[model samples]
Target: MRYLVRDRMLAFHEEAWVETEHRQRLFKVNRKLLRLRTTFDFVDTEGRQMASIVKKALTFHHTILIKQDGENVGRISKRKFRIFGDRYKVTLRGGRRLRIAGNLWDREFDIADDSGTLAHISRRWFTIRDAYAIDVMSEPDWLLLVILAVCVDHIIEDREGEQLTNL
Candidate 1:
């Protein structure tokens, strides 16, 4: 399964639409404003809350929590002391661990589980705003994948902002 994630144009708040390859809406990503830590809510087309991604406050590394129905289902956190490309750990609820390794700058990466590559994410898809393509090879964990994509974008943006200030 694959999906197209696109950001809304000219919006004050962060908003995006998660659609099928045929342009059918599947989910909505809305950033909650005025919060201490960055947060996003993912809702189904019927307007039902599906999951949420929240950045942890005051963390040394980029840490994000994925919650479904108010329960922590997974997490995306940066690996420590990495000098090369970006790395992240995705821990599912039942202690299963997945590794996220890729180049954040190019917004291309792959997630692997014990069996093998579970999904591949790439921003090669053309769009007016930031957009990406998610190719799911295995059984789909839709919300988790979406949150990971958003987290990657935020992590890269934050790093760029820091570099700008240091200049």
Candidate 2:
């Protein structure tokens, strides 16, 4: 007799970007983490302006308040948080979590279930290409490539913005 264990896992790649007259912000999703803490510099394509944002968003708080439609939902306190490198973890109120690892201007992310089946939540103009070998599971490789793309896109966008502003 064979016993099968059904482990439900979902994963997907995503990218986010915002364009403005003066600047553009982008982010890419990478691996998920239980806990993350780090700092990185933000530079344009020319590698100028070495400023950074110090972030410390974790998942150990007693209760995380999620507001929807200006209404407060029930408190959430038992979710896991994962941060690999400069990536950020996005958690929804409904036990669903999205691990994002790119920049605010251009990013790539994956939404998955606990068991690891990849899913496509949404896609935008930004691209999510798969490259590299990141983990034994063959998922991290693609995630890294996505992150790189996001960073490059942000740098280019920033450069363009700066040139326009100077004119």
Candidate 3:
């Protein structure tokens, strides 16, 4: 399946939607306001919290914790060393290591592990700047993967001083 995401105007509190190719809203990413740390909450269309990514304020590496039901389900951080410049490493709660590598800042990349490539994410300029199209392959945990991609996007944006929600 393919989905689209659009960039939001610069704001301390930002909001955007994860939608299907047909433009149906799937999830909402909310960067909460007045928080000590940057937090992006994912919610279903019905307004139920699906997951959240909370940035670590003082970590040596750029790190964020993925939480569902108030429990950490995964963690993503920048790899100190990369043989080929793939910057982020995702460690799932169940001991799965997912590697993300490609033209990341350009919004094109792949998420993969020992098994194989899981998904391809790339920016699609559909008359709107900073739009992304995510093509999911045979991964059963596609939702998490989508959230993961968005989480990475959020982190990258923060790094570039685009949306410094924590401030």
Say which candidate scores most in TM-score: 1
For candidate 3, write residues 49-148 as lDDT tens digits: 9999999887887888999999999999995445676578899998989988888768788888888888889875565666888888855878888888
State each model's CA lDDT, in order: 0.82, 0.32, 0.83
Clashing residue pairs, candidate 1? none
For residues 1-167, what per-residue lDDT tens digits would candidate 2 score against the true structure? 11111111344422222222133332222322343532223333453422332224454532333333344322223223334343434344455554433332333333233665242212243233322111213344333222323333333344468779999
Residue 104 displacement in candidate 1 (angstroms): 1.7
Error of 3 at 127 (Å): 4.1
Tens digits of lDDT, candidate 1, 2-96: 87889887899989998877899988999998889889899998999988989888888778898888999888899646888788888888999
Candidate with best lDDT: 3
What would the TM-scores of all predictions be? 0.91, 0.23, 0.87
Better of 2 and 3 by lDDT: 3
Candidate 1, residue 50: Cα displacement in angstroms equals 0.3
Better of 2 and 3 by TM-score: 3
Using lDDT as the measure, name the better of candidate 1 and candidate 3.
3
Candidate 1 or 3, higher TM-score? 1
